[model samples]
Target: MSGEFHLSVVIPNRNRAHSLARAVLSVRDDDAGAEIIVVDDCSDEDLSAEYSQLQAMGVRVLQQDSRRRGGAARNRGVREAGGTHVSFLDSDDVWLPGRHDRIRRFYAAPGRDRTVLVSGALLHIDGDIRRPHQPDWRPGRSLVEYCYRDGGRVQTSMLSLPAGIARAHPFDEDLRVNQDTDLAMRMDRAGIAFHIDPEPGVTKEESPRPDRLTTGAETADLSFAWYRRESGDWSPAARSGYFLQDRVWRLADSGRRPAAFAALARSLVPPVSPRETARRALSMIAGEGLYSRLRAGWRQRAPAPADPGLIAAGERWRDLDARARAFCATARDAAAGQPGTIQ
Candidate 1:
C-alpha cells in the first residue's frame, strides 16, 4: 500500500483494560503500516497503567473530557487520527489473523478512492472461530436497497473508509445503541459507495459485561425516531414489512411464541394476507428449532446457533419428543417468572 492511503486504527476504550491490550496488539501484530489510536471514554477505574504500557509499545492514547460513550470516543479518535484512511476496533474485540494483509491488498486495488467504503465479514469467537456472521445482503450503487430495504446492517470492525467521510459523517454521539448503523446510513446518504467482502474480517469477543448495555436495552425515543426517520423514505409497504419481520425475529429468538404469534396476527404490510404472513413467520421461527411444539415450547439457548437449524431432523422418535416436550414446558414456566420485555 502507498503512503497516500495509510490506515489509522481507532479503538474506543472504557472499562475493558483487560481486553484493550489484545485489541491493540492485534493491530501491532500485523505488518500493516497503520497508526494505532486509543480513545479512553472516561473509564470508572484508573487504566493509566494499561494505557502507559500501550503507549510504550507505540500505541497513542487520548482521554475524553467526559464519559461521552463509544460514539463520542470514536468521533474524537477520528479528529486525532493521522492517517487518511480510518478504521475502528471496539475495545472488547480483536482483529482476526491476516486482516491487515487481506484488507491492504483489497483497498490497494487501482481506482479505489476516498468515496469507496469497504466492509468485510466477521467470525464470532466465543471459544472458537468457526461460526461466521455477515450481513444478509451487500450494499450497491443505490442506497435504497441497503438502508431501507435490507433492514439496516453494518458493524464497527467490518468497515474502513476515508477519514474525510468519518469526520463529515461522525457517529451520532447522543445515540447509545445502533450508533454505527446510524453513521452507516448517513454515509450512504452522503454518497459513499459501499463495498463488502465475504472473508471473515474480525473476531468479535462476546462476554457478559455489566457496564455495557445488556440485551433488550431500549434506544432513546428521539434516537429511535431519528433512525426510523432515516428509513422513512422507503415505500410504505417495504418499511412496514421489514418492521413486522424484525419483531417476529426478536420474539422467536427469545422463545416467546405467544408474543410471536400475536405479532403475526397483525395485518400484513401489503400484498400478503395475515394468515400467509403468520405461516411464513412460523416457518422461519420453526427453523430456529421446532422443539416439542413451539418457540414457546423451548426456552433454552440455541444448541448450535451458527448452523441455525434450517433443515428438519429426519424423524421425531417418540421417546425424544416426550423428553423435549417436558423440557420445553419447564423452561417456558421458568422464563415466565422473569420480568422485562424482550426487545
Candidate 2:
C-alpha cells in the first residue's frame, strides 16, 4: 500500500460509440493516474472516428483481429496493461467520480491484508432481482454458490483484481453470457481471496436492450464448460436448477410466456402444475407490472449471508441511510397484497 498504486482500466467494447465515449470520459475524469485501455471487439465498422477523442486523451485503443467478443478483448488489454491492478469496465457502464481514489484508500485501510480481488455493489437501473436470492451475501474465502442466489451478482464492471491474479485466470473467451459469473466461480476454485464492498461502484444502465452482450442470450450459441460445477456445499443438480430457474424468468420477462412455461416444464427443478405455470405465464405476458409484483413476492425469501465478516463487509450499504431504506421499502411494497405463505 505504500508504493505507487496504479490501476489499468480495461474496457471491452463494440458498437457502443456514445456509451464508450462516456465510459472513457468517466475514467479520464478520475485523473487518478489510471491507465485506460479500450479493446475494440471488431465492430462491423471501425470506431476510430468515434473514439479518436479518447485516443487523443492518452487512452490506448486495441482492436481484435476479428470479432472475438468482450472476453477476448479484455484478455488482450490485460496482457498489454502495465499496472499492478486491473479492472474491467464494460463499454456501456460508467464509473462514478472518485472511484479510483476510493480504491486507493480501500487498499490502505487497516486490516487490508493479502492479495484479494474487490467486488463492489451494483446499481441496477431496472426491476429488483429475484430467484434464489441472497440479498446480503458477500464473498468469503470459501467457494460460494453464487449463481443460484438472487442479488448475489459480482458484475464485471465492479471487479478489480491484482494483475497477476487476473493473468493467472483469464476470461474464457468462448463465453458470451455469464462470463462474469464464470470468472467468479473459477476464481473461487483457484482459492483466490475476495473482498466485497457493497458500495456502488458502477451505475448499470439496465434496460431490455436486446442488443447488449449481457442480455443478448449469446450463451445460447455457446457451450457451458462449468454448467454443473459443484463447489462448497452445492450439488450439481442444485447448481443447474439455479440457472434453469434463471432461464424461466428470462423467458417470462422477455415476453415469451409460452416458452417460459415450456422451459419450466422441462427443467429438472420440480415443476408447478401446468395450470399454475400457464396462469403465471399469462400474467407475465399480459402484465409486466404484475409480473414484477409476483416475482417480488417470491423474492421475499432472499437469504442473507450468516457470516460475520461477509455481513460486516456490507454494513456500509445496509446503513446507506434513506436511500437504502427506500430501496428495501420498495421491494416490500411489491409483495404487498400477495398471500405470504411466509414460505
Candidate 3:
C-alpha cells in the first residue's frame, strides 16, 4: 500500500467471463488500492457488457482484437501497469486472504530489492482432491532442477515480482504451455534472487474445460519442445531428471509411446536418479491410466496435512470462495439486462 511498494494485479482471461468477476473481486477485497487490469485475449463471445460492469468496478479491461494467449496478455498487462510491483492471477484463480499483506511485508524488508520474484505455496483444487503445492526452491538449486527433479511448481497465480523486472524479462509468447517454468528458468539463469513464501496465498482451481490449452492434445509435444529448448544450458542431472520424470509421463499419457521410450532411453546415456528412471519406465510400461491409479492410491496412503496453519488457511479459502460466489451473483444481476451477462 505504500508508495514504495504499490501492487498491481494483472489477470489474463479468455472467454471465462463467468469466473472473471471472482478473480477481480478477490484482488479488490485483498488490496483496495491496488491496480487491477484484466486483459481479454480476444474471446469468441462478445464481452463488452461484462467489461463495462467490470470497468464500473474500477477494473481496467483491455480487449485485444487478436488472440495472443495468456503469456502475451500478461506481458501487455505488465507494460501497462502503473504500480511499483506486479502480481498475476489467472481468470479462474483467486487470491487467499493476507496475500496483499504478505507481499507488502516481503517488499518492505531490507535487501529485498535484489529479489526479482516471490512466490508462495498454492492450495491446488482438482475436482474432489485438494493439495498444497509448496515451493521446492533453495539457494543453490536451479529452477529446472527444483521443478523436474524435486517435483516443485510455481503457477502464475502464485507469482509476484517488480514491474520493471517483468517488463525486462517478458514471458515467452511463443509458448502455449510451460510459460511459467520458462519465465522462472530465465530469471534463475539471470542470477536474480527469488523468494519462496511457505504459506499458501492463492487458491488455484484446475478447470476441466477441454478447450483449456493445458489439456490440448498437443500439450505433450509442446512441453517436450520447451524442455529441449530450455534444457540446453541445464545440468545433466536436471536434464535427465526432467526427461525421466516430466516428459516421459506426458508423452506416455498423450499416446506417444515411441517418443516416451526414446526419451527414456536418452535419460540413461548419463544415468541420474536410476531409481526414479526405473519407476518412470515401469509407469510408462503400465500405461497412463494404471499409472495414474497407482499414484493416486499411493497418495491416498500418504498422510494428509494436519498443520494448524494450513487448516486455518483452508478455512479462509472456503470463506473467500463463498464471498466470491456472492460477488459473482451480484455481478450477474447487475448485468442481467446487458447483452453479455457472464453466464
Which prediction has the highest lDDT against the true structure?
Answer: 3
- Show model 2 residue runs off by greater than 4 Å: 109-116, 122-134, 138-144, 214-218, 221-233, 236-241, 253-256, 262-343
C-alpha lDDT of residue 52 in model 1: 58
TM-score head-to-head 2 vs 3, winner: 3
Instruction: Between candidates 1 and 3, name the one with more favorable lDDT.
Output: 3
Lowest summed lDDT across 10 adjacent residues in model 1 is found at: 308-317
Tens digit per residue, CA lDDT, model 2, 1-343: 6666789999988876666766776677666479999988877754545555455557788878789988899999999999878888987666755678777777666555344444454443352211212246555524344444332556688788778788988998977666777787778777776666555565555645666443433343232334534333665443444435355656555555676666666553444234445655566665867766676676577744464533332342233323334433443455454422200
**Which order, best to worst by lDDT?**
3, 2, 1
Q: How well is each residue in 1-343 modelled by candidate 1, as lDDT tens digits?
A: 4746678999998876556766666667564467998988877865655665566557788888789989999998999889878888887666655666666776788656645444554443223333443335543534445533443336787778778778888888877765766677677777676776665556565433334452332432343365476655666554554445444544544555666566555425443335446555667655644522463445245445533221211111222334434543543454454431210
**Candidate 3, residues 211-287: lDDT per residue as tens digits?**
66765448987887877777777778777767876677667656678888998987885676677777788777887
The lDDT values for all models are: 0.61, 0.62, 0.76
Q: Number of backbone collisions per candidate, in order?
A: 0, 2, 0
lDDT of 2 at 160: 85
Residue 42 lDDT, candidate 3, scale 0-100: 84
Order the candidates by TM-score, highest first — what do you get?
Answer: 3, 2, 1
Show pairs that collide, candidate 2: 132-150, 133-150
The alpha-carbon lDDT assigned to residue 227 of candidate 3 equals 79
